[model samples]
Target: MRAARFRPGACLVLALVAVLAGGTQQASAETSPNLAIDAPPSAVVMTAPLDPSPGTLLTFSVAVTPGTNPTSTGLYVNCDLSWLGLGPSAPLFDDGTNGDPTAGDLTFTVQATIPSGTKPGTRLGDCGVFDAESRSASTSYSVNVVPAATDVGPSVTDTVPLSDATDVATDANVTITFSEAVDATGSWYALSCASSGDHTASVTGGPQSYLLDPGTDFAAGELCTVTVTA
Candidate 1:
């Protein structure tokens, strides 16, 4: 009791220690809950319209869910239409988090242009999505390419002047009009030049006009001949 009468400093030290202990307890009680993701680990779903038409644009939708809502996440989808062996394969599309949890579904769309002259059969390929962090939970879908009506024909309507004076451009391009859409793979089209040069060509068009690009250009004032085989 005699020591306490002169122990103001000791009392002050005890009060500070009690205040710090109370603050630490309150901070621990206010902590946030842990984040979580609940998507299927190895599942995916995709859908498209029935009886899709050739050369017509089609939309494909894909859905993906992640096993855990990662602090950092992204979605990627790759499609191969080469089974159709059309032109080039379809490009990949990305579907990131749409301000939603990582465990929810994401949708993606693409336009399908049936090859200019695709055969009547089923086109097959695969589609898949993966997370940057947890790739083990990736999902994939089998893509099917269905046959559509074929009404393309071969008929040349007109030709326009080309602008290759030097005639050195290997890929000189020109325009050709058509009476109707022609089958690009059909045996009714031929592109040639009169100069007897080592030149190759490809034809690309829709319902109205075809763009032709020669692997090599013709001599000055030399005429290039294009034949359509339908």
Candidate 2:
């Protein structure tokens, strides 16, 4: 057998070998930001104050940590308000311009309101926290709806024909809507006229809705005013 010799050309390739004394595979990076709902012992923590008044704002946060910056982030607060079917949605906010909230810190806010009728004492409210990454967290918070120092005084909320109404039809029955309920004793319409023109309420309409037929038909051009005594 004859020994052959290799010649190096202009494009000759050389094999490169790397040897490690301790031969260990490299560790994967962990800078991917994580979505943290809140601080804890309790992940679901209350952001509202103790004995919060009805209509008080309750707030919480969706935080990111050890997060790779240059990321787009956002959050939302979801609550079912019987008074208002759905809460509002939020939009994303990016901090990449400043290279901030980039690696170890950043948070977004989610806020809700305690309904006016949220009874006095502790009430449980579950508000959802959603982040830009499509991750979600929920916090069950205890809110103390402060006792209404004063009675929930009844007030007119809406009316059928509208207020300061002009050119109203003579046959039109006045419909008044109240914020809360009232009995016949507390519910009455006092007409500007001293004479009781038949101010009768219709119970069938709804507890909050009262239809009043001003005793009799209006004298044309008579400026009539009706006030609800609740």
Candidate 3:
């Protein structure tokens, strides 16, 4: 996961390099970056939309600042990655070290691939940033994902039993086809029988058709009307 929030229209560039505890060397970074974790705001889950999919290749970064407290094992971190279509990284921690801001900040990189079966929506996870001595601080993260949208509306295509045709048979189901997926979410149309005799009508069938079947048969040698309205 990325430590910095992904801002829309902002360049998403990061640098992370895993390193074991060792003596300090000349830092590659020219200028140090701000602390990834702050007390007041308190670092939490990120807001950037990774837009992850199955087999998605992702890379991110994190920052660990130097303080008076330094543990032998370095820092410890906990975060939720299962919901992000991946698992946690190995030994989440960083050794306390300070590099001149003019010399650049020490940035660490994290990379992973999104697993299959991740759905399109908001995913939340936990993130814990522990101090060098194993003192733990935790936060939550959120990732919003959405699928590509194609703008297309549904329309009526064909209707059964041509209107105003004579000798229309009774005890038959009226099937209507649609141009696109209609009422896919839920019921968006109604079917009713409007004629001399009492009849019941309902919206039925798959996304395309609205099968209007009358509960009672049509009268003999009499005109009957059926209406389908959205």
Candidate 4:
């Protein structure tokens, strides 16, 4: 048999293969871009100090980092003043647009008025951030309110003592001063003598003060103590 001669088409196909292989090697040498967001250690952190008085203005902020531009983002706060248990539910105040998720490194402000007549103690509330382009993030915080202290004990600022040795009594009437003006019908005073037992207590004149009438006689030249519990 005579040796057969191959066509030039084979050489062209081999050349094309060499070109494709070179292109693939070049592509593998290129670097890629980072398409992820650097979220904070804590998605939500305390942004402001708590209010000290009821009805005081409270402001806070939230920080977020989305791997990509979000389609929509906003904040919502849940306030619970249920401790009062006598009025409407606590209201939420927001300062950011509800639906715009295409932005990055966004800061939002939330303001709320502490409900009036809130009890004096630590109040808890929660906040959350939602990015329609991503997921929902949330946090919680506490607000502390100091109680108003009022004097609810007796005073002799405007009382006169009986004269004459024989007419003078060892026992004296006690008075009380309330920290705040309270309803006389709803408020009462309690008095207990160290030496004697429970004594009768009464509210006289205005709603802010109370007078205690001694139920038992006191010994002369003896030390006596009275406690007014509100």
Candidate 5:
């Protein structure tokens, strides 16, 4: 007899990195030997929601000092979140669109979706300016990716070795998959062998998947109960 059990685990709060790209108004950037490399904004002020949930459509705004840069074709926010398993890079605009208050103002803004499955935490990235010649310089910034005020814990979506499996292989490993990435910081698991008494297994795997390997094979003809607590 082989049985499987699941216990809800604590939620791990991570961030959604947003990479800022070139604005639409900016002239096509081309390399030029005489192009002047504008200095990064003398000041960078980013504006974002206090608490944004996954899949939420939100506006990110960045205001910089010296709104007037004669040599600058446009300004932009440069950052990346793909490393965090989230959405790709996007641009922040100063053209009075995408939530910008005024066109030509140093205040750049863009409306973007917070990729679904993004964990809750502070997401950090960079911001900068670009010349028509494609030269750029940037400064750092951070945004808080928060969960909804009314939030729920991660749930089990599926598992390996379907529940109540019989005649299971002695060396079969157990795997658990979740609806969302789990914290697994203080998680644990156990393998109870009816004939061999208590048994232990090593736990491994990731943000949404977990694997369990027993130290030794299970008894040939005995009840094996595997319990996992996320």
Candidate 6:
């Protein structure tokens, strides 16, 4: 069958995919307050460091609203993020502990580790916000885990216009390859010739390789030197 073009029906699916890729998902259950004994949470909140890496800590919290359950007090919270190796049904607290900001505010919070060796990805899951009794409310949550940044400094692996060369092209651009990805912020290069004096070049390109495009060419038969600082 031929592929379908942009249709209204595809919008919902695309939007859902976009959310799953880089957004949070949440849903709340509807229950008649007067008929229930346990208060259901109106919202669940999960927080972590920006682009958290494996082994980082994550916090989960839920806000409970009073229902017709007049006797409900001392609310409890538990979350299942076992996909991250944290035990299922891990407890959260509202007693101004375990990262909770206030006690008896109906907002319970807890922290859990992402665990070492956890691959980077967006993980979707849920938590249970319960009253003092057996009744509980469910809320879905997600975490976006990113790969850890490498700590090893970059080293030059190779370069164009090889170390020392005879009769070289004056307008040639210098290219360099690095052992690892590099940050080019505040990077610069200087090219000078024995006969032509100091020269200037625009440093460009990226994490693994860079190119140096000189504004002026080297003088013929002149010894040239290049300096790079990144």
lDDT of each: 0.56, 0.52, 0.52, 0.51, 0.67, 0.75
Looking at candidate 1, what is the lDDT of residue 207?
Answer: 57
- Where model 5 places Cα greater than 4 Å from the true spot, the runs are 1-40, 66-77, 81-89, 133-135, 151-230
Runs in model 2 deviating more than 4 A are 1-150, 193-204
Model 4 C-alpha lDDT per residue in residues 1-230, reported as the tens digit of each score: 99989879998999999999998988887755657663422245343344466656555455544423433444333334344342233433333333222233455444555567777787665555555444555566666776544536543333223212233355777655555555555434454435554566444666665565666665565444444334
lDDT of 2: 0.52
Provide the lDDT at 207 for model 2.
Answer: 76
Candidate 6 TM-score to native: 0.47
Model 5, 1-230: lDDT tens per residue? Answer: 88886444422221111112343223345542475444534446465565677877766666665433354455565444452343456566778887888998777787677777888888776656555546566667676777766667788787787777888897888888889998765546667888887666687898889887878888787887766674
TM-score of 4: 0.33
lDDT by residue for model 1 (1-230), tens? 36545688998999999999999988998896776755533435454555565665555555555446443266555455564443333444433332222333455445555565755555545665666765644334444445665556556667654333344443457677767765455544566666664455676775578676776666665655656554
Please provide, for model 2 over 80-160, each residue's C-alpha lDDT reduced to its tens digit, 9 standing for 90 to 100. 333222333432123422222333334434455767776677655554555466556555545556765665687899986
Two-way TM-score contest, 1 vs 2, winner = 1
TM-score, structure 3 vs. true: 0.34
> Given candidate 2, what's the lDDT at residue 209?
80
The model with the greatest lDDT is 6
Residue 220: error of model 4 in Å? 39
Question: Model 6, stretches more than 4 Å misplaced?
Answer: 1-41, 69-71, 152-230
Which of the numbered candidates is closest to the native, going by highest TM-score? 6
Per-candidate RMSD, Å:
16.8, 16.8, 23.9, 13.6, 32.8, 23.2
lDDT, model 2, position 66? 21
- Model 5 is weakest, by summed lDDT over 10 consecutive residues, at 10-19
lDDT tens digits, residue span 1-230, model 3: 76977665443322212232121233534355655443321233333226655556544334444333232234444556766544663333233322112222323334555555556787666665655454565566666656544557666777787666677776766777878766643444444444546566555787776677767677556766554455
Q: Give per-residue lDDT, candidate 1, residue 70.
A: 48
What's the CA error at residue 164 for candidate 4, in Å?
21
